[model samples]
Target chain A: MKDGPDIARIASLVGDPARANMLTALMTGAALTASELALEGGVTLPTASSHLAKLIEGGLLTVAAQGRHRYYGLAGPQVASMLEAIMGVAAGVGPKRARPGPREPAMREARVCYDHLAGEHAVKMMDTFLARDILVRDGQEIRLGPNSHSYFTAVGIDVEKLGPSRRPVCRDCLDWSVRRSHLAGQLGAAILDKILTEKWARREKDSRVITFSPKGRQAFERAFLEV
Target chain B: MKDGPDIARIASLVGDPARANMLTALMTGAALTASELALEGGVTLPTASSHLAKLIEGGLLTVAAQGRHRYYGLAGPQVASMLEAIMGVAAGVGPKRARPGPREPAMREARVCYDHLAGEHAVKMMDTFLARDILVRDGQEIRLGPNSHSYFTAVGIDVEKLGPSRRPVCRDCLDWSVRRSHLAGQLGAAILDKILTEKWARREKDSRVITFSPKGRQAFERAFLEV
Candidate 1:
């Protein structure tokens, strides 16, 4: 007897290419202006504006007035997670559009998944963490190991000082390309922040790819890839 | 540099109300005919046929020849999983369309999610299973607990004889209504099959609601809820 949630409304909002691009741009965990998003969506400013308004109305995004300009971001992590889940299904339902673009290789290697890193390196890191007992499975949830606080401190993230957040501290997100688990949630976001702040990788312009510098790649390998 | 997966295409397909209705109807894990699907979608046969063509072309569904008619079903488990994920996001994004219908109460009480049971009863059963250690967490996957075979057998499901399939033996699907884990995968499908076959619950026609007879309800509680 239940008529279920109205998935079509949200689905159609994300279904539009221009809006999808705008939303994907925000998944970098960075706020962007309408013009920037318009450029990313490959649409005229007016069209982009209309799309943005719809997105806000759809509850998929939020707008903030920083000054004369307005900054837009995904309303919350749920939007990003929803987008990623759709991507996973799309990857499986490959046809002409599912073809990998020129940047696909780089994206497959390393990319930003919402607030966290996702790709080959990210999946590998998840596997290593599970293997080393740095992350433990707690029923339906994943938890950080009891003695893994030192590991986080060494990587410049203070677990206790993550402040307050409604989201879980440790979460496992499905990586589209790898079809495996990737680190997500509060700690996941912090780790991505650390990587960028440390100059280990730089997020590409208007793209999800995160290119690690040669030295950064080596350092990342040494830290997470090895014991 | 990566132009990520084209989620917009699939989203748009499901975004259409008629198309979405048709797809959701198929989520019962039953193979429905074109005419039946047309009725569910609330569209004319011609319109439904065109829509079905697009869905088939889009790779969201599959068709099989049976006698003189064709039966449609979700392409695989991934489609069902993706639909549930979307439902989860839509549930959180309650603006106006998220309002519960009269049947919402019934759906919330007991319903089918794709191939398995969902709603209050389903979530309760999952909690009890985990609490009693009938289900164990194996990293990101859920596994059956050792010595729990008797419990499943008593419920009339033989895990070992579930037949070979690409899908896992046990999977945890997110329950949109409860925002909790519910059993899915081969074992889950088997349990649902048992439920219907044993007359524990009768699925409501043209809806997701599964109404349990009074006698059946008591038996279910004693079997899964009682120690």
Candidate 2:
């Protein structure tokens, strides 16, 4: 038998409908209060607290106490990615839910997937990067190429100031909607941040949808296009 | 909130300790009898059957009746990949078990990941393919280049015979041990099959380990290396 970390423990933590909802909500990359999570999970605050405790203990989530208020978020990007992968498989193989979200198409066009861009627009950006040789892929690994710095700089992103970090600079995260790869890593986050700062897009309140303005869409396309 | 498939339903099926063990055991890509899974899960035969039924119902597994006996295995490659991704996250963030298996080193060197090869040797083969331009990586997608046909044909993989399938010719599966990409998909399965058929390596009984003999190791290296 293969010896590995106990996946059951983690899966069980995510197995509950209430907990799954909370985790999915947290994938928006926001630190939310218990009340917010409770609403998200369709559970009471006390019930949400208990579930949050288990997730925190299981390392699936982390809590920060600010004075009397406690805010919870995903433990890290790995947790987010795992949830995304779970959603990917669930969407593919599992039974359909009774009520589908009303914003399915908008969500699929652009959304926040744990602090990084995902969905169609993100996939397109990734494709453009590869087509322009700005990002080079070697097997499973992705690396920023020589042209990347100039390109990112041209788009008003401080490529040099990203600084050194323990996290990988570039990574490929599988997009659930498109069934393709999108950039996910420090660079991915930086790119999303740049877009938001430039007013190219804005995340919808209480939702994962990332809506872009007509002008912003044209600007984004022109900026990230292959030279 | 995102309205998608009910992830909790499928996850809870995998959440039970006994069921998790059985699923992990099935990760070897071998279809085993209920009695075998019972032993793997350290549960009673009836309990194992119940859990297997739930997994099958949840679409995480599938069962086939062979004569008077029933054999259980993962539903498909997607299910296997999902399990692998779960394991990857579990290994990274979850609490460590008290008793780590003694074969950890060997398991990490070369072991079966579902159906295809994984671990060190598999990562090396993927690297060689990229270095030789036999497999081209376009961002998150991998494509078999012009050089691929001749190279695979030289190695006795009837490239033309692989035929058209819904599955892609190449895929990059993230290796848990190496934290890198390894080959997967139809072509990956074919390479592993070729290695086994040519007596280059043999899978250890009741385990995922694929041990290559000294001579076989040399032959594998020479065969995969660029001219």
Candidate 3:
């Protein structure tokens, strides 16, 4: 066998249509149960179990026990990034017969990417951060700006208490729909978590779309968009 | 058939072992004939032909005839970026039993990523550019710095006439092995083209490893690493 990282194995695991559906559903960043995933994937429960087993075995997903039920989520942000990149290519090269679904517009407006916000609203937040110097790019990496600590703390994301992790504090992920980028990594997740916790936005039921109330949207703008 | 981009079709194309090998081999940015790809993929010519046809149909690759031989290469930069991203996830989630190949060390030191240089040397060049303010990141986008035009022209890369293309002038590609970023996109390709044209390095036969002579290596450092 030619020696290198095994690309074929991972690609094969994701190549299955049912599994692809399941994985995409998990991109909402929510840990879902097998039955829910089966429904989303349009596969039987047994088939879903088998697919989930393979995904877990491949490390593309992680399983956790909540109460008497087990829930599945993407392994982490890296897997999400990989899947997003794949979608970018798929969108680029797929047959030109695409017909947008009813949910397409809402999804393109705002959605969850793994654990972070994505789409138009998310892009705006990232732009505001950069435009106001809350975050700056150094080389290819996004670094905390001079006032980032103060800015994030002001928004209830205590930078000092983010704890330690191998993941960067600030990173950017390409938005496939817009061909732009939104914030990702730990800081991005924190911002998203804050949004949901404060009831600024709520994830639409059984979907990745995030819906913000009029007041919440205004509050979000005041907090993240104000220079 | 489900909604959104057709990811399964594209992932399935990359799923097959032979096809995955073929795609990775083409990531060197050199167009190879069916026979050469067959050798790289460890498959028979007929099988390689079948795979090549499928890849072309899928838009992951493009073919052109040079003289009597048909050479196949990746369709474009987007395809290459997709493959690199896939490799990143593969390396992340693959089995932990990786044993280095004979050429692994050399490859990790320096390799070609599609039309650009990758690995350590490429990373250093990116760092130097940022440090010297020759390239500045403006909100996840790399734009020309004050001295960028002059610096690139001094190095024989005319910033004015790169031509109008949808491709970004500079983008950062994540390096899987190092968990760092390397320069990619149009400017990146130009630098690589210049390096090869100037005989600062030569591509290894039958591999992606770039071999820079002792003097060439020194010159590269002096030019890029100099303050």
lDDT of 3 by residue, A1-227 (tens): 35457888889988999999888777655677999899878899999999999999999999988788999989987787778778978887775535566788888889887679988989988889888888987775788898898888777789877769645677777776776778888888889999999999899877778999999999998998885
**TM-score of the second chain for every model:** 0.67, 0.67, 0.92
How much is A204 displaced in model 2, in angstroms? 1.4
Candidate 2 stretches with Cα past 4 Å from truth are A225-227, B1-4, B26-46, B62-73, B96-103, B110-118, B125-174, B180-227
Clashing residue pairs found in predicted model 1 = none
lDDT of 1 by residue, A1-227 (tens): 12678888889998998887787778787889999999989999999999999998888888999879999999887778778777877887856654568888898899998789999999998888888887887654789896578777776678988858788888877777887778888888888888899999999986788999999999888778775
Give model 3's DockQ, 2 decimals.
0.48
Q: Please, what are the lDDT tens digits per residue for candidate 1 over residues B1-227?
A: 12678888888998998888888776656677899889878899999999999999988999998789998888976677678767867777656554567688899998887678888998898788888888887665788997469888877678889868646778876676776778877877887787889898999987779999998889888877773
Question: Chain A TM-score, candidate 3?
Answer: 0.67
| Per-prediction CA RMSD (Å) | 4.2, 5.1, 5.2
Model 3, span B107-191: residue lDDT tens: 7788999999888888888888988889987654687788898898788888777758888888888776665678898999998
Rank by TM-score, highest first: 1, 3, 2
How far is B63's C-alpha from truth in model 3 (Å)?
1.5
Clashing pairs in 2: none
Candidate scoring better on DockQ of 2 and 3: 2
Better TM-score candidate (1, 2): 1
